[model samples]
Target: MEVQSAGKETYRAKTSKGEATRQKLLDVAEEIFGAKGYFHTSVVDITQRAGVAQGTFYVYFPGKQHIFRELVEELSHNLRREIQIAVNGAAGRKEKEIRGFAAFFDYVRKHRNLYRIVQEAEFVDPALYKWYYRRLAEGYVKGLQEAMDRGEFRRLDPEAVAYCLMGMGEFLGMRWVLWEKKDVPEEAFRAAMELIMGGLEKRD
Candidate 1:
């Protein structure tokens, strides 16, 4: 009983070691949730694979669903961070979009489980799934709107354009990285770029 009481004290990560343990649980949850899926995975599965005590799992996440939610949120943050970093030095909207796509492809390659986890979120938690994409679109729309204001891009509905661009990136990544386990081929990438840049380019 005393040991259980002590373990409950770790409900949230308060120290560096605690944070590491929390992150480990999240990492393990990401893998299991991506592979076995939310319904199929169990807390014990994450704990055993993570080499942590079952109580430790509860310490970080209240339940399996909490961990799954955290995983999706974390992936969203990491993907956006990578894209931002990749596009920071890009000179213009065109370069920024291209570099952003490249960054996304690289991230998907490394985190292939991304597709499974996010897609499954639609069923597991519909609102969460929508939140995931909306969070992504918010940043994209802001960037597109900025370009439109600068006359770099056509003055169109930024949100609409953002979704279309996101769809293109999503399918391209799915086809090349997730399905074929290869980089998006040069031709496909070029076609995508041309479609995006040509359509959005401001005309005289």
Candidate 2:
């Protein structure tokens, strides 16, 4: 939905073919940007790998930076949305937290490029990099606040709690998924959940 164009018209893919081409470019760009640092990649590289004319890339994204920004935004949106869906129908805050971590690991396994691309955004566009995490943390903080109000979690600083949990999940995913090339082991998941559950859950 964050499509943009160089021209005043503001481009969008109106047909099936057009949409497919645009998606192809984004998919290829994700791989290219991940394998090669964003600073090293070019529009020509994306178009070549995507099997589309350079002009076709322009039809969807105005420039390399535009596509990178949009891709990061799209990734952030998808991650948050998936977490929301996974945590749905959970009976309690602890269950929601457990399911959310599972969903995150599942997503990372499928989109391994996300870790590289997100890190590169700090150099490519610092604002977009911050926006990505801030957007995710906003939802996390909201969830924490709700749990606190429900007496499920202790009354802690929601923002601090949000960052703590995010850091834990990020590192866990980085260690097991990105580095190990496998889903986090069941023992590791249980250990982490126990740590988080102890730290946040109310005693009484």
What would the TM-scores of all predictions be? 0.93, 0.94
Instruction: Give residue 42's error in model 2 in angstroms.
Output: 1.1
Q: Write the per-residue lDDT of candidate 2 for residues 64-154, one digit (tens) a residue.
A: 9888887887788899999999999999998999999999999999899999999998888887888888888999999999999999999
Runs of candidate 1 exceeding 4 Å displacement: 1-11
| Tens-digit per-residue lDDT, 1-204, candidate 1 | 101222343366779998998899989888888889889999999999989999878778878877877788889889999999999979999899889999999999999899999999899878788888989999999999999999999999999999999999999999999999999999999999999999999989
- Model 2, poorest ten-residue lDDT window? 1-10
Q: For residue 30, what is the lDDT in candidate 2?
A: 89
Q: State candidate 2's TM-score.
A: 0.94
